[model samples]
Target: MASPDGNHRHPETNGEAKPPAPKKQKLSTSITDSEIQSEFSHHDASVARINNGSFGSCPQSIISAQQRWQLRFLRQPDSFYFNDLKAGILESREFIRSLINADDVSEVSIVDNATTAAAVVLQQIAWGFTEGRFQKGDVAVMLHYAYGAVKKSMEAYVTRAGGRVVEVQLPFPVSSKEEIITEFRRALERGKENGQRIRLAVIDHVTSMPSVVIPVKELVKICREEDVDQVFVDAAHGIGCVDVDVKEIGADFYTSNLHKWFFSPPSVAFLYCRRSAKLSDLHHPVVSHEYGNGLAIESAWIGTRDYSAQLVVPSVLEFVNRFEGGIEGIKKRNHEQVVRMGEMLAKSWGTQLGCPPDMCSSMVMIGLPWCLGITSERDTLKLRVHLRDRFAVEVPIYYRAPKEGEVDPVTGYARISHQVYNKVEDYERFRDAINKLVGDKFTCASLSA
Candidate 1:
C-alpha cells in the first residue's frame, strides 16, 4: 500500500481520511438560516421565472409528456410507441452540445456534479490499476487548488495501488501567469525526475479556494508531450463561471456541475471525453449495463433512476441565454465582478492577490487576516462557523500544506466565489467581516492604504 510520488489518489483511500487540513483563518460574518433563505429566495424566484416565462424541458413536464405517450406502454409494455420520448432526449442533448461547444453529442454524458464526474474518471483508472495496468512506479499529479474531494481521491488511489501521488503544492501570493506556469511545470518536472511516469493529472480550470484559474491548456500540452496518458479537469466552479470549450483545453476528459454556475436545477452535471478516447475502454464508476460501451452513447444514458436533472440541462442553457447575456455576455459580467472583489480584498489584506488580476475568469482568491498559527481542520471549522453563524454566507475555506521550495503550500487562506447569483454587497459584507475579526495578524495592511 505504498503510495507513489507524483501519483494522484482520492481522499478516501481507506476511509480514515484526514479532514482537509484547512489551516486556520479569520472570518467575520455569519451564515445563518436567514442568509441561506435570502440566497434561496433569489434562486427560487429565478426558478419561478422558468415555469412561467418559458420551458425548454423540465422533469415534471417531460414526464407528463412521456406519460401521455407511455399510456400505450402500460398496455403493450413490450413496444410502447416511444418516438416522442426519444426525440425529447435527443433535443436536450443537442442543446447542451451547442452551449459547451463540444465536438458532438456523442462525447457528452450527464452526471450529478463535478465530484461524481471525477469519481467516474477515477473508477476508470482504478479499474485499470487493479488489473495490473498501473504499478508501483507510475505517478499522477494534482494541486493544492484541486478541490478537496478530488485531491483526496487521487491520494487514496495512488497510495493504495502502490503508486505515488505527486501533490503539487502551488505557491500563494502568486504574482503572474509565469509564476503559475512555473509552479505547475516544476511539479511535473519533479515528478518526472522522481522515476515516476506521470500517467494522469487533474486540475481545476477555476479553483475554489483561492478562486484562480490554472494554465490548464498549457498543462495539458505539457502532459501530452511528456507522454502523460490522461488529464481530468474538475469544472465544478467553472461551467457557468466561464465559457468552456473542450476542444480548446485539449484534455482527454473534462467534467463540470452545470447547477453551480449555470443556474441549472440542483443536479445537472456533465462529463466529456474527447473524441480521441474510446469509451469502450473506459469503465463507469458504478458498473452498469453500459459499463464498457466503447464510445457508445448508451453509456451516458445508463441506469434507471430519475433523469430529470439531466433533462433540465437544455432549459438551463436556454435560461442563461435569456437573462444573463448568454454565454459570452454572462462570462464577461462575472469576470468584471470577480475583479472588483479581488481588488477590494487585495487592498484590505495588503497581500498580493492569489493569481494575476486577469488570470482568472469567475473566481478570485484574496489573502485575508487570520490567527498567527493555525491548522487546516481547525481553521476550516472557524470559517464554517463564522460564515454560517455570523455572516449568513456560504463559501469554501482552504489550506495548502508545504511540500518543497515554496512555503508550506499549507497557508491560512479564504476565497470568495462571485457566481451569477452573487452581488457586490455580498463581497462588501465578506470584506467587512474579515476586518472585524482578523484586525492585525492578517498582514497585507502595508499593501492596504
Candidate 2:
C-alpha cells in the first residue's frame, strides 16, 4: 500500500510482489514542437487549452504514477493510512520546501488548495482575536483583486471575531510597479488615519483575473513600514509561474497551489510559515486527532482523504526536470510564449496589453477590442461561454468598470496562459475567433446581457 519512506512499494503477496517501476524517461531531443501535446496527451486536442493557469495539466507519466499510488491505497487501506501516509506526506513537504526555498521543512505544510491554506491562516488569526492578541476593530487588509475564496475566508473568520477587512484597490492596466506600491501604501495610510490598527495584510503574488504579477516583496516591506502586524501572501499562481522564494519574500505566511502551476494533480498546495511565525497559535481549519500537534502533524491527516496527489509530488518533480532548464527554464519559456502571443493578439485587435510585459508571468492580459461591446462585468460570463462553446478557445475574459478620471466606461480583457503543450496555432485560433466576432458586430446586446 503506502511506503513508509514515500517510495512506491507494492504490498507483499504470495511471491508475486513487484518492485516499483523506473521513472519515465525525459522527452528526446528529437521531439518536435508539434509532438509536445503528446506529453499531456489526455487533454482535448480539438480545443485550444490555453488556460493552463487556472488548473494545470499533468504529463501522462505523472498521471500514471498517481494512478499507481491510488491502486496501492485501494489494495490495502489500513497499512497505507497507519504506516505510509504520514511519511509520504513528509516526503512531499520536503520536495516543496526545496522547490520554494523554505527556511525549514517544519515550516511547510500541504493543504488541499490555496483556499484551504487561506482558511488555515485566517483561522489562526481569528483565534488570536479570541485570545486577546488582537482586539475588535483591528483590521485585516487585502487587495480588491484577491481571489474570491480568500476574501470570503477573511469575511467569515476575521469578521466573526469583530475584525475588519480593508481592500486595497489595486490599479489594473497598471503602468509600473511604483503605481501598485503607491496605491498599497495609500490604502494602509488611509486605514491608520481612521484610527484603525492594521493587524494583517494579504498580498497577491499574482492576481487571478486580469492576471498580473504583483510586487509582493516590496508590498511586504510596505506592510512592515505601516506597522501592520502580519503579512500573508496569497500566491495561488506563484509556485511554478514565478520565482517564489518564501524566505526572500519575508512574509509571515505564504501559500501557492501546486495544481495551478507546478503540474501536480488537483487539490494540492503548500502553506509556508516563517520560522518566527507564531506556530503555537496556527492550526488547521479542521480539528482532528492531531489537534494539539504542530500545523504539520495536524494538517497531515485531516481524516480519511485521498493523499495520492500529495504522494505524486516526486513524480511531478521528475516530470518537471524533463524540461530543458527545470522549472526555471520552463517558466522563462512560458513567459516568452505568452508575451509574444499577447502582443500579437493586441496588435491584431488594435488594442494594447493590460500591463507591461514585466508585470506578467506565464499569463498575459490582452485588451479585447471595444468593437466587441463587452460593456460591463456581467457580459464577461456570456462572452466567455461563447468563446468556449463556439470558437473552441479556452481563455479567461475579464471586464473592468471605469475608474475615476478614466475615459472609457467599460473595458474588457482576455488573459491567456501558455504551458509546454501550447503552440502558436492555439493563440492564432483565438485571434482569428475574436477578429471574426468583431467583424460580425458582436455586442453585449447580442449576448442578452
Candidate 3:
C-alpha cells in the first residue's frame, strides 16, 4: 500500500524504483458482502444514493471511530477537552498535511467546513482593507461557476470594505484550459481598466453547479501574471475527490471539505495557508480563547462544540486507505465509473456532457435534454424533488442561466456522483426511472434548434 506521503516507489533492483506488486484477492470471513453493505447501512437503502458529491456517505468504521471519540469526551469531558483534544487535533492536522503534501503542518487549520475556511480568508482580506493593507479600489476576482456561498461571502466582505467583486463569466459548456486562463486574464485587465487594484482572485478546484474541474495551477500562474495579490482556492471538492498537492498548486490559500470526499462526518474541513503567503491577521469566525495564539490554534478551539468529527480525521483517512485498495484506488474506480456512467447516460438520453472527461473528478455533469420541462431554476428544483420523492433517486439538478444579453436558453445539468458503494445498477435504475418519468415527451430532437 502507498504511504500517506504519496510515495509509491519500492526498492530499486537495477537503479530504478520498482512499483509495488498488486495485492492478491483472498476470501475473507470477516469482511463479507453483508459487512460491506453494513458499512454504508446508514444511508437509505432504497434510494439510489447518486448524490455523494453533495454530502458523502461515511462508512461504518469512520462512524464508529467518531462514536468512540464522542464516548471518550462524554466519560471524561474535562480531561478529554483540555488534556487530550489538542494532541488529537495536532495528529489529525499532521496526517492531513502529509496527505496534501503541505509544507508546514502549522499552516493547516481545521475548520467546520470549506465555507468557514473561505470565510477566514475573506474576512482577513476585509480586515486588511480596513487596516490600510489593501487600497480603497481593491477588487476580488471570482468565477461565475464558483460555489454560491463562497461567492456571496467574497461579495459581502469586499462590498463591506469598499471593494468591488469582479466576476469572470465562464461558459457553461466549457472549452479548453487556455480559454479559461484567457478569460481570467481578460477579467483582470478589465478590472485594471476600471481602476480596480485586483487584490484577490478566488478560483475553484472543482466547480459546484457546473461540476467542472478548473486547472487551478495554471489559473494561479495567470493570477500572478495579472498582479493579483492573493489567490484563494475554493477547493470544496478537492482533497479526496481529486489529486491535490498544496505545494504543487502554489496557491496563496486553499480550503477543502473532508466530509465531501474524505468520508468524514459533517462539518469537518481544513484551510491551508501557504508558508510564503503573508496572511498575518487571519482568524476563525468564532473568537475563542485561542484567538491570538496563531492560525492553527485559533481554529482548533472554536468554542465548546463537538470535536468528534474533527478528531476522527486520522481514523477516516486510515479507514479509507484500508477500504478497497486505499484512497488512490478508490479515486481511480470512482473516476472510471463516473466517466462511464456519464457517457452511457448522455448517449441514452441523447444529451451532451457538460465538460470533457479529463476535467471531471468523480462527479460528471450530464446536460439535461430540453424536453425534460426544465426551463428555469424553479423547474430544476421541482424536478430534483420529484426524482427524490417519487422515484427515490437522489440527484442534483441545477440550471445555469445564459450570459447577459445573450439569446441562448438556460442550460440544465444533472450531476451524478459515484462512490465506492455505488454500482452501475444504481445509475441504470436512474436512467430507466428518468425514461419512465419523461416518456416520449423528451427526445434528442428536443435539444436541436
Question: Largest TM-score belongs to which candidate?
Answer: 2
Candidate-wise lDDT, in order: 0.59, 0.84, 0.80
lDDT of 1 by residue, 259-292 (tens): 6666555566778888763444654555565445
Return the candidate ranking by lDDT, descending: 2, 3, 1
TM-score of 2: 0.92
Cα miss at 30, model 3 (Å)?
12
Candidate 3: the clashing residue pairs are: none
Better of 1 and 3 by TM-score: 3
- Candidate 2 residues 350-434, lDDT tens each? 8899899999999999998876777677888889889899989998889987667966433899989998888899999999998
TM-score of each: 0.73, 0.92, 0.89
Alpha-carbon RMSD of each model: 13.4, 4.6, 7.4
Q: Model 3, stretches more than 4 Å misplaced?
A: 1-34, 402-410, 440-449
Question: Tens digits of per-residue lDDT for model 3 on 99-166?
Answer: 78887677788999998988898998898789997788788889988898987887788778978788
Return the candidate ranking by TM-score, descending: 2, 3, 1
Off by over 4 Å in 1: 1-87, 194-196, 277-279, 294-302, 348-352, 370-376, 399-412, 438-449
